[model samples]
Target: MAKVLMKGNEAIGEAAIRAGCLNYFAYPITPQSEVAEYLAKRMPEVNGVFLQGESEVAVGYMIFGAAACGERVMTTSSSPGISLMSEAISYISGARCPAVFVNIMRGGPGLGGILPSQGDYLQATKGGGHGDYKMLVMAPDGVQEAVEMTMLAFPLAEKYRNPVMILGDGLIGQMMEPVEFPNNLNKEPTNKDHWATNGMDTRKSKEKNIVKSLFLDPKVLNDHNLTLKSQYEKMKKQEIRFEAYNTDSDYQILIVSYGTMSRVCKTVIDNLKIQGIEVGMIRPKTLFPFPEKAVYDAACKKSCKKVVSIEMNMGQMLEDIERCVKGKKEVSWYGKCGGDVPTPEEIINHIKLLLK
Candidate 1:
């Protein structure tokens, strides 16, 4: 694997191709336009399809169409554009279509700004569209994870028959970092003629496989919900992933963060540690299949006192931290939104206040 300097957005597009995704469709959006441009050049070289849809809404439906054909497909866009595609995204979730949606988030409530912001943390984690469903959200800190996690996403999406979101902030999308490409994708997407609305084939399921999230009867909905709950439980066991830094050093303060903010938090950890202040970090890679057990274990440690829930949003995941370690540990939140970035020194100052 040879390392090459690449932006996170470009890495994701290339990784999708490397991961055997031949169908690409998306509308242009700031901070993520590189993804479309990258695929435009790369897909043609490989005889793959690259379509610039008329709108984000059209692109999402195109994803549905390709997934229905049992094809490995993907799309990329930023905040408000994603909002426009919510209806289709909900449809994709309901259909249980196996596809990848890359969201390089920008500031938003509505056309907020084009700077880095993990403002969509709640939206991505909670099935950004609608209905009672969840998306497998994979957050990447740098270009390497941007590619690796995307490669991981296709298989994971197929394994669970769920749509996966590669959630990144503008910093991750625009910042250049060294990344190593896979020599070969080495795997083909599983044949999904079973339920795929693709033409009836020998591998089709005996009954009409209706991909749906609707159950009219209360009992049916309950059973479906129970099944979904079971899936979440399994994800917690199989997919709860995070990185621990300086955690084993008996730190009294723990910084819980994800995406770009976590990188800033890391610098703060170094500053605090040098000043003889005990601080640690728990950076989550998968936000939905949260690392609740890790937080619980940290809370049980007498050395751990307070947990800081930091993100680029107005404390959405903060509620999640409270649920994970409430009563057992005091949880606090510090963040900015609409494209505002927090400096490492500021994070250190915040930690200093906590340590007081």
Candidate 2:
């Protein structure tokens, strides 16, 4: 396959189309608005549906409706936009409808800035909305990985009959890089006759398919929640993904990071290695089913004395890192949330300080 140079957001839109997802309903937001812009033009050429909803809230429901009808659907938004869509996301999860959401995170507590930040890590992994719900969250470090994750998200969502999220910082959306859409990822939408409300006549089933999230009876609701819990547990057993860097060596410090932050840590590790300071890193690909065992084992290495959680947020992933380390090694955090990414030099300085 010939690689093409493209913006991360544009690559994501093209990836989705290649995956056979024709229905895209979204509202434009910074750093990710290019996805909407690109798809708006390309969708028509492919005879796909590209509708810009009045708001993210409306877009969320549009996805839910399409998914309930067993159509491949997706939406993209930034931090505040995703917040408005959280309620519908919850409903989609409870109803067991397969859908995809892309969050190109911007700085925030509330509409902070248009710059890149990993502030939405907690919201994506932990529940953004009310209730015991989780999305299969994937974080991409670069444009090419972003394309692959967006294509993979569709099948994963359908496999589990739940929403899947592509969590990228604004940098991942704005940066241009060479990317190739894998031909293997081009696939037909899965069969949804078991639950989709497409139509009895369409599926040739006598029973009517009704999609819903409202469970009035207490025991029934409890059972539904338990079912969701089982799926999440299954994910933990089968879907945890991560990348280890320089762990083969006897490293003095282990760094746990993801997305764009991990890229910086990689550079830091290489520069430190040149100076006789061995620093290792673990980059998580899946956020919800976090690579807990990877972190735990790396931290337990005898050569590793300190562990640090580096992110673009105010240590949102720190709690999870500490949990995985389990007091075996000292765990700390270093980060910036004002849209300024920590430079490799800054990280090396921090590591040196920790060692001293």
Candidate 1 has its poorest 10 consecutive residues by lDDT at 194-203
TM-scores for every candidate against the unseen true structure: 0.95, 0.98
Alpha carbon lDDT at 37, candidate 1: 94
Candidate 2 structure quality by residue, lDDT tens digits, 1-356? 89899999999999999999999999998989999999999999999999999999999999999999888899999999999999999999999999999999999989899999999999999989988999999999999999989999998998888899999999999999998879966466675775589877788677887899999999999999999999999999988989999999999999999999999999999999999999899999999899999999999999999999999999889999999889999999999999999999999999999999
Q: What root-mean-square deviation over C-alphas does model 1 reach?
A: 1.7
| Root-mean-square deviation of every model | 1.7, 1.0
lDDT for predicted candidate 2 compared with the true structure: 0.94
- Candidate 1: segments with Cα more than 4 A from true spot: 202-204, 212-222
For candidate 2, give the lDDT of residue 125. Answer: 95
Model 2 lDDT, residue 186, Cα: 45
| CA displacement after TM-score superposition, residue 28 of candidate 1 (Å) | 0.5
